[model samples]
Target chain A: MMSANTDFTLAVEELTVSFDGFKAVDNLNFYLDKNELHVVIGPNGAGKTTVLDLICGKTKSTSGSIKFMNKELTKLSEHEIVRAGVGRKFQTPSIYENLTVFENLEVSYPRGRGVFGSLMFKRDAEVENKILEIAKEIMLDHMLETEAALLSHGQKQWLEIGMLLIQDPQLLMLDEPVAGMSVKEREQTAELLNKISAGRSVLVIEHDMEFVAQIAHKVTVLHQGKILASGDMDTVQKDPKVIEVYLGH
Target chain B: MSFMYEKLLGGKNGTVGFVLLATLILVVFPLALDGFRLNLVAKYLTYAFPAISLVLLWGYGGTLSLGQGIFFGLGGYGMAMFLKLEASSPENTAIQSTPGIPDFMDWNQLTALPWFWEPFNSFTFTLLAILIIPSVFAYLIGVAMFKRRVGGVYFAIITQVVSLILTVLIVGQQGYTGGINGITDLRTLHGWDITSDFAKNLFYFITCFLLLAVILMSRFILTSKFGRLLLAMRDKEDRVRFSGYDVANFKIFIFCFSAMISAIGGAMFTLSVGFMSPSFVGIVPSIEMVIFAAVGGRLSLIGAVYGCLLINFGKTAFSESFPELWLFLMGGLFIAVVMFFPNGLAGLWEDHSHHIKKRLGFITSLFSKNDTAAVAPKLEGSN
Candidate 1:
């Protein structure tokens, strides 16, 4: 199912992913608009994270077409997909724990990606300022020199986000951005996501309905590898199928 | 000056450590040791190349190769071939059936120089072959393995097998490669007899200089951003890949780079030892080379040099007195270093560096009572 539309930032048409005989994501159709903050909500085993994996090219789709900015995504590898301006933060806080917070962010800086480029790369004023700016944005300015493993759970999540921000991708996809965070951290992350969404599209897979309601411009409910409902949060929450399968249960 | 010191030596204490090492190798060793001892030190320095390569490959890049000896052997053979050809000049080998060919070829009843031996007649081509051949092998292995996601223990095992294969091949192909004895009777390099004591002394100085230069180059890479990326990749491969880097390319480059460095050491080894042999191109020597890096601090380039020197010195002395016990002692040393000091000597130094600095300050204070800037904190804190 190919989408002829070029207006959408990300368009997935009839996406299906299967492991052995079981379908993880089946015939999924989704689209993300420019500068939109979209949240995916679902019950356990409903494939909310699978959709993200499919989008980020972490899982190969059995049958589908994923077009990111009018370019076919299924043909590209994971790193190529990332270079194509899609940044994904995993469910767990995946960060370089041994390195300092500053080093973690510096790794994701868009420049010096080439082998020789990295060799010649200097921590010049521009790079230093960018790292400091991102550190400040993530509220980690004071801890830039601290090792990442020492960061609190919430801080690690933010550090991973800061890593993504350093790259400044056109689209940011986060899986469970506030799963293990405290209430205060959740609130801070919501604010951070809102600020970041000003110039970029965000696709968040979140189970916390309260967190979703706080920052989501639109929400989609997935059930057993398909989009059960899609609309504004209020409308989708009230829908009978959405209530029966997800929120009500 | 401070920036340069910090960048080159790692930090203030690192500068002290670096200076101590430089003085020991460059100034102290040359002056204190006799010619024979000096030549022995040069031989030890040759092994340091493989150890230093491990600092980059296994220590920083987290790519462990168990077959560095293969690269070393290839490089040694490359140099040996040239030396053998030079020594077997038509005038020198006039008594043999093959007057222009290496004596080994004549001994094996070959009347003609083999096609492969033709290029080694030129010293320049041999030098190029030494640097490039092993790296090409490493590149192939790296691309084949890393691209397909074969790594960790599996990579180590494959490299070990490669060392075994090369050893067997060199031993089996006696006529072509000088067999198990290897390419011996290497007399001269471009008409200068390398076996001469004066030439040995000169080569010793050259080897020391090259080893020092390698340390500097390694230090430069370790301090660079690329080095940081290697650390990043070692910690989290997936994250680096997701950050838009072709991870295989980095692994391949590092493996090839390590091979080239090991090759340099191998060439140096042939020059100093005066022969190349299959005894060096096997699993045991390969594993021993890794131990040198491990004991010296696999993460520290300078430490690798010291490790190579210390272990070789120990092996020479220990084996002479108690040959059977030396093997057991070596095994014990490996286990102890692995278990007790995972980071090795450098790690040990780093752990107590503050105390060492304080002691240094205290010693200085005894000499000059007003030297409070260095010892004030310790003195006041103690009081």
Candidate 2:
């Protein structure tokens, strides 16, 4: 793992998001270092997902400045954020269920995500080969031709991860990555995250303590739209406030 | 084999088969049917145009527009005005003095044609009016509605009001619009004798080819990324907006395209029926177009064509047999289709055939394997 004192990859300053006169995320501030696997855990309605939404440009921050690699992210659209190397996976698998696994990965490629790209059937062999290679690395080669809907819940989640990997984003924000996954699948996901964290900055939103411990190098606990605590897993887990909110005190 | 059968039955091939069947029936009907039936079929083809537009807007674009009839009316009026001007008296001096010039003008005691109606005297001007007026109206309404993010049921209601307003305006304009009776007695189009069989046949062919072209164009759009984006918009509009697409622009484009298509259908209908009237472009007819699309299969392009033919044919048959219960029958059909087959008839076929073959193959294989096992046991025991 990279040293703990490395330069920040993502920096947020006083981010707030409001909807219909009600604030969802309020005056949040955080910084994620390069090659760090960070976890954001909180109770329901704690603005964890909303923070990710702001970062991914799904929801514009009411008032804030988000800088990624010293570039302002507030003005960028979702596709622009994606092009700038930020990948996000929704709580539910947001893949094309009718398409084959390989086709799903192929569709996630930056070029294929646009209007003209979807119409034309032209194939970039290098991209295809890379996708195939990634699918193989994720042990999805056998299921490459299978429709995404037919895959098990665990496989679908993995396929979504593989899709994000193909985009080759500099930062990945995964929401509840292991919500419905089996124990074995959870371990595999943890291992996958560990493998990818070597070169990329990962912000994982997970509730499972064991899964977070296995992969997260640093953790931030959010409660009611504010950060309650932030530190390494052991430090955050021992915090009385973190325990009372996340786990029964 | 069963798997292959399932693939063939459930896949795009089924859609192709349906399209091919429709083309065959349309091509052969004129040859076998008498002139009256041929004319009715031609009328159905023209009606199919508006339905086709609805399919693109509602079925594919996911915007349920109820004001398509307004565009249709505009096109019809445009053509009617030009044709009436052409058939007017040669001595231009009488054009201003005659109060009973077009009967409606006499009823209202009007002195001269409306200024707006003057330009429509030329065929070229009328044709341009047919395309431009409806498109501009749709574009303006679409921009306003979409910019405000007013969609779904709100959009439907607004469009309904638009059609209602248009119908009332046309009906109240007794002097120029021919009042509730609307402008009729369209004897000729660009000097072609519309009453002649050759002209009718020529128009019928034109309608058929145009319908085919629209269907192909819609299919192309549906298969493209824009189509997928539209579907995404339908599935989740906010997600699409967040995905960096200009949702309002897409909506406006589709609305304009739909209006243009509906206008073409309207022009064809006027030419074929030899009249343009308020009744044909009223609120009821607008709703009927929605029913045509809904009954056929909203998502299927072929379904739109099928729906138009089926409903029109059923209407003709029922009205002739029992006019009072015709509405009841249509209502019942819609209710039954909606309650039982949510995906419509096309969806029903897609779901059934694949599973049926798989079950049949499984049963046959099971019995054959059991017989083989029984013979093997008997042979082993005998040995």
Candidate 3:
């Protein structure tokens, strides 16, 4: 087993990704500490999500090393990276719309994930209890049997979070978790993020600075496929390069 | 009783439909139809196996394989090879130059039985081959394409090509596979005459029993968490992958399972019909199998069975009277089904069954307040 580095739960070094002739991410370095919530803020096409995709093995980095717990993640497949203790929720709420809330959580419960194992799996008391517990945490306890498509936009976002929680990953990466949510929903999501980040690390790509200020322990401002500024929200907001490249626009 | 009925048949209406279907096949058909017509029904029901497989693979998994007939043909050939060997006993083949070899081998100037065909001499090996060969073939295809994440129309096109290749291979290798005519004159199975009326009836019963078993097995899979995962994968494959499933493995398993079930149908086809032909192992029959599933309701297992029977019955009836119009009519049916009833007959039934059930319940309440008062509330609550 690769020992989990106490200082850094995740570390990326010299990451570069170029699609065709245009470089989406260039020479990027990022890190997240244990129990810390790190936010990546940038304009559209600033490669904020691409960096998360690189760490989670969703996009192939042209040149880089992403180490999750001191183990290189770029060499692994998306599913393997997930099993290695990194969870990702997409930019859009990617919950199973046709399935019930209970089923959505049940699928992402992270046990019996193989083909034959899944076929023979039974919902035991322990699994049921865990599902209910997560449902309560996501504030969907009463809607467990309701189809996810019927869920409000904010509820779908929470359900996706609940899905990632069931996997119990040490690192949770959420892309634009508060996008399209109402102000109240954003506040609740902020609280939910802070509550869930007690023991694990969180990496969020968010456009909502207010939500980021509420939850982000450290903020990295990206500009033109590079990290233009890195500091606390107040410090990054004051950084002249960040202001000119992102906030000024 | 209600729990078992719902579990097995899918719901209350499903249970009623199942009971009606069961009675029609087991009681009414035997009593009403003569031997000739009964045999024809048995032949048609043999198709339900492939149709049910399509429901599991294409309907649920969202992997459309157009080479189902390849598996079907492999199964048919497996059983036919065994029966052909039995019929071509040394005494029976004494007139041929190769007295112990099948007649086709003699006609093709082959002196010895092929080594591959030697295994078919054993009934156990033939049965196992019927289940295993097609699954192995399907496994290879599934792995090659799914591992690389090739799907959608590309997968469908490749499967169609595979069935075409199999047909050409069978036709070209006449000496080995009995060619265009196929392995015919399969008179017996272990010295028992399969052509006899009593044996035909027995095989028909066995076929129906096995078809029911397969249907139940399919229903069990479709209701399981595995089935839900399949639906999730169909909708958002990346989400399923990130949820820690090797997506290719699930596709492979379902593909192989579908192939095995389709093969069983092919085996039964050989036994009841006493022949196995390349015509059933090609692109045309494969697409026909898809149509059966589509018309029945790709998502409905019971619907697939009825779809196969209805289509086959129409084909037989139309071809007998209006042979020239059969092709055009089939084409029209395919288009109409796809355009108007995308979910097939089963979807149509489910659409209106709620209102039908409600009306029926109200009528029943008029007749007897106690039963409707008890049943009506439960039905409303479930919806």
Each prediction's total of clashing residue pairs, residues at least 3 apart in sequence or on different chains, is 0, 0, 0
**Candidate 2 iRMSD, 1 decimal:** 3.9
Q: TM-score of chain A for candidate 3? A: 0.96
Write candidate 3's Cα lDDT for B1-383 as tens digits. 75356445667766677777777778888889888888888888888899999999999999898989999999999999999999999999999998999999999999999999998899999999999999999999999999999998999999999999999999999999999999999898777789999998888888888888888778777776789998999888999999888999999999999999999999999988889999999999999999999999998888999899999999999999999998898889989888878889898787557557766777766675665566666556334
How well is each residue in A1-249 modelled by candidate 3, as lDDT tens digits?
233454789988888999997899999888789999999999999998888888888899998788988888989998999999999999899999999999999999988888878877788899999999999999999999999999999999999999999989999999999999999999999999999999999999999888889999999988879999898999999998888878887
Q: In candidate 2 chain B, where is summed lDDT lowest over 10 consecutive residues?
A: B2-11
- CA RMSD of all predictions: 4.4, 7.2, 4.4
DockQ of predicted model 2: 0.29
How displaced is residue A227 in candidate 3, in Å? 1.1
lDDT of 1 at B152: 90
lDDT of 1 by residue, B34-103 (tens): 9888888988989999999999999999988899999989988999999998888899999998798887
Scored by DockQ, the top model is 3
Local distance difference test scores for all models: 0.89, 0.78, 0.90
In candidate 3, stretches whose alpha carbon ends up further than 4 angstroms from where it belongs are: A1-6, B1-14, B357-383
Error of 2 at A119 (Å): 4.8
Clashes of 3: 0
Model 1 / residue A61 / CA error / Å: 1.7
TM-scores (chain A) of the candidates? 0.98, 0.93, 0.96
**iRMSD, per candidate, in listed order:** 1.0, 3.9, 0.7
Prediction 1 global C-alpha lDDT: 0.89
Chain A TM-score, cand. 2: 0.93
